[model samples]
Target: MSEATHTTEILIVGAGPSGLALAVDLARRGARTLVVDRAAALFPGSRGKGMQPRTLEVLDDLGVLDAVRAAGGPAPVGMVWSEGSRQGELRMFDVSEPTEAEPYQGLWLIPQWRTQQILLARLRELGGDVTFDRELTGLAQDADGVTASFATGPEVRARYAVAADGGRSTVRRLLGIGMTGETVDPSPTLVADVRVPALDRDNWHLFPPAGETGFMAICPLPGTEDFQLTANFPDPDTVVDLSPDGIRKAVTARSHLAPEDVTEVRWASDFRPRAALADRFREGRVFLAGDAAHVHSPAGGQGLNTSVQDAYNLGWKLGAVLRGDADEALLDTYEEERRPVAAAMLGLSTRVHRGEERRGRATQQLGLGYRDSALCVDTRDSIPPDALHAGDRAPDGHRGGVRLFDTFRGPHWTLLTVGTAPATDLPPLKNVRPAHIPPYEAYGTGVFLVRPDGYVGWAGETPTGLTDYAAAAGLA
Candidate 1:
């Protein structure tokens, strides 16, 4: 049972959305990464079909937003049916239009499989690839790096390892970390992808429950001929059958469609809705991400979005540290900033599952930030409470013949001066691009130092303490 040995800068333990997104980001930044998945291929299902606005922005930064849009569409209106009669349509989400600051205002419907395909394609385009059928059997880390042993292949040595292997993460278990949470719903749910020849693709079809039955929904997946069928079971102890015949029977019992209406069953699974957060996101050189760090119910569409964001937030920090532009201490901020966010989103998901909240602004995730983080340094005086501060997301707009997001794109930090030039001499910072713009209402008049992840790391009225801050952040 001897093992071959390999080495990489970063070893990602799963090839799902989180791992793929992180690989793409790191590859574009000239970091060497090895992504391995225990499964044989990419996921082939329509689960986690809702993509929030913030996630759309992340895709745009990763250079795959156009492809994602082409592969998917907006959420359709839900049509209600009772006793084989059409009832009034019900809106699944509050409608909101795009604005200058916030371009993506609503949820987009893209199958999780399609999203992973786009990310994988982008990763390969950036010179990265994922090795499938490589199951991690054990991992050990010391003061310098981590060594991961696989079940039947070579061992991998990496400076850092991330566990994106989902809720029952093997890496987390090997690290001896515990999760703290509760079951949001004990009832079982059946979700399946099927081809319904007689169903229309214009609207999401909903069927009200009959006596002693639960609600059912059949949503038409965008850009595909398949429909996603979801049915809730009333009994907590009931076993859900996932076979084709079993799914056909469930549809027949819950809706007006007969058993024969379901032409084919492509994929099916069952789960009890639950929410949980890891006790810690980091352990030595190992880190937890995506479902490995937090688990959410599918009600608010927060689980996948939050998972992708976890990768986005960690990617830049890892790139900076690995490229020698920032100190290793930058990695500590990943857990500090993202843990609270995951906690808040976990609560939001549970609330949405229980029907206590609406799918609106909070679901969009535009208001989430890290103003209280240690990396946020705001030296300006008399700032309004509602105004954008350090650690807030930088707004996108055009001013002085430059698009702010365009300037902020890529793997480098940005120094933006609005309505004022530097009052003092600026330091020579590595990988920090500087620009100037006229007074913009979104940013006001200040000197903003934006991080690679598009958050304001430091803000001041002038360049008085900019050099000192840069030195502290390892940019000098």
Candidate 2:
């Protein structure tokens, strides 16, 4: 077979949740991207079963909340049981205040496969169709752009290439990035989807069967009469079995009931959680995002959520540099902002394994943000509670027909300036957006600037560093 020649404004390798989410983000911003996946079809197994509230906010921004809501992501009312002896009863739900900025206070538990389907559909609608069965064979990056080759297709020259592939990413290996974190044996658990005859569709149950191998968590699927359970079996050496007999035995053993109590088994799988992260998140025109960038124990179920956020963080930087809105320095912020987050998360995930540490019961929802970034100064004290970023997400309200984030637009020179300057007095930040904060003695409080992908940009009390801050934010 001969090689073909193709080019995209941006090239995204990996069709998993992160890559697809990023593709949609860029395509929505009018940046053309081509996503390549080695898989022939979307994986159907329920790999991950939850989406954090932060991720739900991202999906809402993409204008697909209704679809996600339809895809079995209802309000998160979950429970947990401890020790062992199987057969768990219902646990209490931790309720939180739901805001327009965060419509879903809890994780909308949905299978990973369904999440991908929703993202893929959105990508297609946005014109970022995935090229299936096309594996990235080789990659080479230069000062100007990166060149990516596929197994049986053409070479693609994109302004930048992002590797969102899984833990053992070929891109990471090809780029010679080292894995710095530890990888040890993780707690083994079994996950399955079923329809139990006697189980009702209300609360979650965790059975603490004896031997202390770990208990089983059983709960009714939010949208279906089918139920799901995560149980730790007695024999650590026993290979995870997905066969009907294996499923029956595992469920029966955990639920402490007869095998006949369960009928239809829709999904089954085994998982061992571990933590790992790439020593570097970027190398020239090639960058890493999602699982390719970091992998950690899913005890907190944060792998998918962090990966998606990584993509969101990188998407705008890439687009900015590509569209002449920002400079090369902007991309460096990816590693600076995200690597620390992954490290912090890895540490926190390790804590959950201790079983002795006590935390707020709402265990799965994560609140990872760069509020203390060196590049950002808290203008939160200056602003009232109604704003998006008192160093948080930029709030959007209706402006004419196109609901907008008031005076927020980005990819460069976000003049997060305060102190006496009228909106027009702000320096002309080419291709960047200017957000005006009515001056106060506290000054720019709760009014920090956010980069296009929503990380803290250059922040100061005096609305200072207008030019230097821009340079730090990838502006010329």
Candidate 3:
């Protein structure tokens, strides 16, 4: 830590979904970014088997949706069973008309590993690379920049360094950030990705004939010749051999099938749900996002989706600060806007893990928002009583016949006109582009001004100064 001399606009630690997602944004903005991970290779397993539509939107922005779509199969049509009979199909449908505002209808069941591959491939395409065996061993943030030493012996000096590591993030620990939450011990379950000849296609059939040992599985793997079986292990301490035979035994024991009928074991592991978050997301020029910043149960299949969105919230702010278009204060919004979401996600994850239903949930879907945001005005009155709540994201509904998405892209800002000031009323900024729309004229489609990162800037009605909406975007 002797005043190491390395430099980059930004340095990202960890190559998980969060790190890679931020790298995708920063590199896209032409920010000189360097990403490092401790693992030599990406995770190779079936973790986070569900992908919500919101995540698909964020991935689409990063330009990897197609790759992920091609590599993975379709959204899971949720299933529930008790005995040999279907108890019910969890209501997992779009229920809304297709519009640019929000196109994806429900969650898809693609394993997390495929997502990592798609993101890594996209990062490479953007000229960004993740150096592995490179760990963040030390960090020191002064007035000028953040100096970090890598276990690899090299050092990096970045204007801003992000710790997207994980629950036990070395950077978060080095910075002395603490997470708050309790660990929920569900029945420890064994999950293995293997190929059993006659298995798969019943695709996620939860078994045990109602009273036996509940086991769920048949996750389809395209090129691989196997199924991913998830079963409640009688003993949490016992490790599943993960061999072909071990998996076959688990599958057959629960499904009452023939032993030889199962063949070819591919991969396996055990998992338990946990919910937690760092005491803070930012510490000087160094910050944290993703699992390194927060963790929650995989309930409602929100884990990966939440982490990716966390990076999504932080990326543009990091890029803007690096480019000198915005102050470091902008970075403050990451935690402000995302903390609540993560906290809510933790609850949703719990609900999902417990098999909760998702019907006409609420505007919080994508409607999750930030009233303290710089872009949102205080005209809370005009905000239809049914519109949204303080920490809720403004609905992606149409306003003034414009798509809330696609309309706001890249580094430019927009003036969301809803009976408030027009884009013409806004002052000149090198990157901000004003867009105005009337509120009453704007309904089901009210004006929802969004930043490049996808958080609400200003919603509801006319405010004194739209830039005031922007200043609060992060902090003063």
Off by over 4 Å in 2: 1-3, 74-95, 99-104, 183-187, 212-214, 224-226, 356-367, 371-422, 431-447, 460-464, 471-476
In candidate 2 the C-alpha lDDT for residue 249 amounts to 85
For each candidate in turn, the TM-score is 0.98, 0.82, 0.85
Best by lDDT: 1
Candidates' C-alpha lDDT: 0.91, 0.68, 0.68
The residue-by-residue lDDT of candidate 3 on 1-476, one tens digit each, is: 44556578889998888888889988888989889888888877767666666777778778888777776665444456554456665545445644544677655556667778778888888898888888777888899888888777678888888998887799999999998987665566777776666544644555643454555655565434545677776555666656767767777667646678765555677766678878888888888888887777654566677788888888887777777667676777777778877887777666656656453343125655666554345545555555553334433545567655556656555556556546454455456655655554213333445567655665544434555655555322
The residue-by-residue lDDT of candidate 1 on 9-95, one tens digit each, is 999999889999999999999998999999999989999899999999888888999999999999889999998878989998986
Could you give candidate 2's per-residue lDDT for residues 1-476 as a string of tens digits? Answer: 12456877888888888888899888877898988888898766566666777677667666566787887755333443343232344323344666433345655777777789989999889877988898888998777788888788788988888898888788999999998877434456788887786754556665666564456767666666667767775555668878777777876665556687778778887766677788999988888888898877655667788888888888877777777766677678789888988887676666654453322333433345665555555532454543333234543433223233334443333444444453354455655665555443333342355566544554444554455655545554
By the lDDT metric, which is better: model 1 or model 2?
A: 1
**Candidate 1 residue pairs in clash (backbone atoms < 3 Å):** none
* Shift in Å, residue 125, candidate 3: 2.3
Which is the better candidate, 2 or 3, if ranked by TM-score?
3
Between candidates 1 and 2, name the one with more favorable TM-score: 1
Q: Tell me the lDDT of model 1 at 205.
A: 95
Model 3 segments beyond 4 Å from truth? Answer: 1-5, 78-100, 200-202, 209-212, 221-226, 259-262, 355-364, 372-376, 380-382, 388-404, 418-422, 435-448, 460-464, 470-476
Candidate that would win on TM-score: 1
